[model samples]
Target chain A: MDLAPPIRFELRRGAVTAIPLAIAVGLFGVSFGVLSASTGGMGALPAIVMSATTFAGSAQFAAASVLAGGGGPVTAILAALLLNARYLPIGVSVARFMLGGRVARFVQSQLVVDESWAIASRGGGEFDPHRLVGAGVVLWCAWVAGTVIGVLGGEALGDPAALGLDAAFPALFLALLVPQLGGRRARAAAALGAGIAVVLVPFTPAGVPIIAAAGAAVIGLVRR
Target chain B: MSESWAIVLAVGAGTMAIKAAGPVLLGSRPLPAQVQRVVALLAPALLAALVATAALASGQQLVIDARLLGLAAAAVALALRAPVLLVGAIAAAAAAVARLAGLG
Candidate 1:
């Protein structure tokens, strides 16, 4: 592995690599903010705080949806937590890259998410610690900034669904999933997961199907 | 605090704990080979599941709607190797246009 680049250089590279996805992330954040704000009980401030603190788009959106559907706070939190359980494996993958002391590791762990994890682990077996930190910083800022914009303009934005922003969530995931479909095994695992989730959709709660689908990864353990 | 705020705070704390678990517990030790392989596959598998659930299901019901058009547009854009941002834009536009046409 090459010597770690200077923090500034890594930060710049991370920001640049993340810029395109950040726009989509920003849009998602804006939609989440608008949805949370419009969901009756949640106000703009709570929405902003949730985005700032949680920093997990899908989890937050799931929680908000639960709340909107008349679920209690405990139920909403549980749903969000279940949705976020993916971060455990993600954190394990990025743990080696989280350099420095225990405090630094703890603080940096907060940046673990789908995009940052994907970017940092893009090198396959080797991990880029700088990219991890840099991407986390840029993506975090975009998420929070987008939420602020959404909260302020949420009413004006009026119905993110009508704008097709709701579809953008799956669209973004699809875009990310495309590049990973390179190998036959990966494609099979993905197909199995999707098939299971689709089959369970009508019977499951919002986030449960995804967790259940994680079982499909067990196929990776099987020899061809 | 208000109920919403409390929920946010609780969720936030729970999330931070979940995020912290791997780094704190695993430290520098490598995962077992089989575990690592499965972990590697988790992202693609979970992401595929998320895409299916998000695109095909609304709440608890499965329904095909404008989102399908949007997903198709995204697929076409991705196949053409458009920039990631452009893919999203194309999908959104396709879905919005479809909705306007009462296809949603």
Candidate 2:
């Protein structure tokens, strides 16, 4: 067994590092809550519940957007599924690091979000499960809490776009993406992924292009 | 059940199931060599796609708007090795300012 630090230490480290991201996520969650509340179809209770349970920002936003546009639940669900398909590969990447039995492992796996996973990654397919869980917990709390605030009193906060919160998501992702583009293969995948997404956006439905862009990563399968 | 409740529950369950599928099935087993290679690249590819979609696309139309300014400002911040939070703040400020100036 690898002599790792105690879980608490790693967890604290994860939580500490994640605090900044968590604040941003909370702000995004506020935007989501405000948007969902403004949708007219969804109430505060359901919006909060969605944030608490669904816990995926992009997917939740897509679903809410569908509802806002007067689309039915089926369309909303499909859109969310398209956005969430990335989790399948993400989960597989982190599986070997996950510990515990069936139930425990499953609960812990709930912590596998993009931010948490990135924070936990130690490169070359190694992941620190405790850190993943830690960061996930912090972010989850922030998301849910922010949603509650937004759902309860979002009207007072005024428009999120006016505050430029919408730009935060792209910026956060860009920050995360830059560090990963250190190698030639990663840079190639990023360029390919961005191109695929841009090319497909006009033709495909929302979220579809994003998942389809994952195919760009297959470039890594080529012999170097 | 109400339609809203149904949507919420269905989405919640579906997302949870999707999130659990890979970890539950794979357990602690190591990924195969080819899979590992691809997996390593997945973060970069997916993140880039997210950045593009979030920054450029609005619904079906790829509009050139304040978000582009935000992204450009973010790129500058990243080049300067700014912290993540600062990068987000700078990007948000840039976009908000551009929008205030009626540029989109």
lDDT of 1 by residue, A19-82 (tens): 7778878988888877777756477899899888899998998888887778888888888998
Best by TM-score: 2
Error of 1 at A47 (Å): 1.9
Question: What is the i-RMS of every prediction?
Answer: 1.6, 1.1
Top of the candidates by lDDT:
2
TM-score of each: 0.93, 0.96
Task: Residues B14-89, candidate 1: write the lDDT tens digits.
Answer: 9999899988777778878888777777777878987898789988899999998899999998888998788878
Model 1 ranges with Cα > 4 A deviation: A1-10, A123-126
Instruction: Report model 1's interface C-alpha RMSD after superposition on the true interface residues.
Output: 1.6
Q: Across residues A4-51, which tens digit of lDDT does each residue of candidate 2 receive?
A: 569888887788878878989998888788888785647788989988
Q: Quote the lDDT for B98 in model 1.
A: 94
**A-chain TM-score of every model:** 0.88, 0.94
TM-score of chain B of each: 0.95, 0.96
